[model samples]
Target chain A: GIQVEQSPPDLILQEGANSTLRCNFSDSVNNLQWFHQNPWGQLINLFYIPSGTKQNGRLSATTVATERYSLLYISSSQTTDSGVYFCAVGSNYQLIWGAGTKLIIKP
Target chain B: SAVISQKPSRDICQRGTSLTIQCQVDSQVTMMFWYRQQPGQSLTLIATANQGSEATYESGFVIDKFPISRPNLTFSTLTVSNMSPEDSSIYLCSVVPGTGAYEQYFGPGTRLTVT
Candidate 1:
């Protein structure tokens, strides 16, 4: 089983501020995904980036497999972006999830 | 990506009773998984449901307690038997559209509260 670690267990920022969340995995992974759990406890898929960089709206993610690390950037954050962000990695089929980063964007 | 719908979005059950959560996918999926999330905790894989076969349960979970049925590729059910307060958690159903990757899309979880 692979171990996943996320940095900054808790984060707080102003509505227009920027932040970066990092995830590190102990072993090589074939699949990697970022998920945002909203206030209502709904899990929303943010990105499915096994490698390379991807951007969606004001949020972007980059996964460096060689470094066994992934970074999620939030720029000009909005209040709606407040929630728990989870990064998961899997090798064959089973996925190992990080504890998640709790982000709070003050309005 | 496939859209997944779950029945009984929330429920409060009594001890010794069982609750069956149903998961329906808009499209056929190659794999379906059941995960449990405790309050303020991360998701834990309970089992993997395969069509026309018995589900494969993860360590610490048993089929007798969390029975699963995957009659088809688009639908599955997970039943929590002899419920207790400890069984209260969010149960989520997820699926991978096709093979080659393990990226999964999750359903709006069923929030259960057992007394």
Candidate 2:
């Protein structure tokens, strides 16, 4: 089984501030996804990046497969961007999830 | 991406009672899974909903307690039996569209509260 660990277990920043969350996995994986669990408990897929970088709006993610790590960046954050961010990685089928990074944006 | 929906968005159950959750996908997917998210905790894989046969559950999860049924490719159900307060959490279902796409999409989740 692979271990997925996320950094900054808890984060608090003012609105408009930027933050970066990291996910480190113990083994190589073929699938890696970043998800945002909103306050309403809806899990939204942010990115499906097994490797390389991708950007969507003010949020972007980069995964270094060789290094077994992924990074999620939130720039000029807004109040609505407060929630838990989780990273799930899987090799063939089963996925292991991280504890998640709880981000709070204060207005 | 597929539109996943869960029935009985939220429910309150008494101890010793059981709750069955329904997950429906708009499209046929190759894989369906059940996950549990404890209060203020991360997600944990419960089991993989196999379309035809018994489900493959993860360690710490058992078939007797969390029975799963995938009657077809687009629908599945997870039943939490003999529930207790500890079973109070959000249960979510996810799917892999397959067809060469491996990205997983999640359902809205069912929030259960046990007394």
Candidate 3:
């Protein structure tokens, strides 16, 4: 069985602050994804970085497969960014999910 | 880059009742995945339904309780049978559009509550 764990189970920050979330997996993975679940419960796929780094606007992610961990950085955060961020990894069709980091950005 | 739609966005069901959820993809795909997200919890893989073949479910998930049907390339259905209070969760379907490459696009999801 594969294990995926996210760091900082919960976080609260003022708007415009920067934060980092981490995901660690117990095994090698060929597929890794970062998702944001909004207040309305919509799973927004942020990145599919099994390795390397990618940037999308104020959000950026880096996954080091050899280290078996991934990092998600949110810069100049906004209130709309408030939600639960999840990291899931898989070597097959099944994706093992992490408990997620619940982030709240206050204005 | 695909449009996905699910029927009956939300529903309330009585114990012992079964609900069937339909997932439709705008583009054709080889496989569709079903997942469950309980209240205040992360996503859990339920099963992977491949067209023209029986679905392969994850551990702790049985075919009898969670039946999946992949009738075609773009359409799939997941039935939660013999439901109970624990069956109350958000059920979602996802697909790897086009060449797939392990990038999944998920549907809006069906919110089910069993009382």
**How much lDDT does each candidate structure score?**
0.95, 0.95, 0.92
Candidate 2 root-mean-square deviation in Å: 0.9
RMSD of each: 0.7, 0.9, 1.2
lDDT of 3 by residue, A1-95 (tens): 88999999999999999999999999999999999988888788999999999999999999999999999999999999999999999996568
The regions of model 1 sitting more than 4 angstroms off are: none
> Over the stretch B1-88, how does candidate 3's per-residue lDDT look in tens digits?
6788998799999999999999999889856899999998888889899898899998899999999999899999999999999999
Off by over 4 Å in 3: none
State each model's TM-score restricted to chain B.
0.98, 0.98, 0.96
- Candidate 1 chain A TM is 0.97
Which stretches of model 2 miss by more than 4 angstroms?
none
Instruction: For each candidate, report its DockQ versus the true two-chain complex.
Output: 0.82, 0.83, 0.69
Report the C-alpha displacement of residue A99, candidate 1, in angstroms: 0.2
| Candidate 2 structure quality by residue, lDDT tens digits, B32-99 | 99999999999999999999999999889999999999999999999999999999999999999986
**Angstrom error at residue B96, model 1:** 0.1
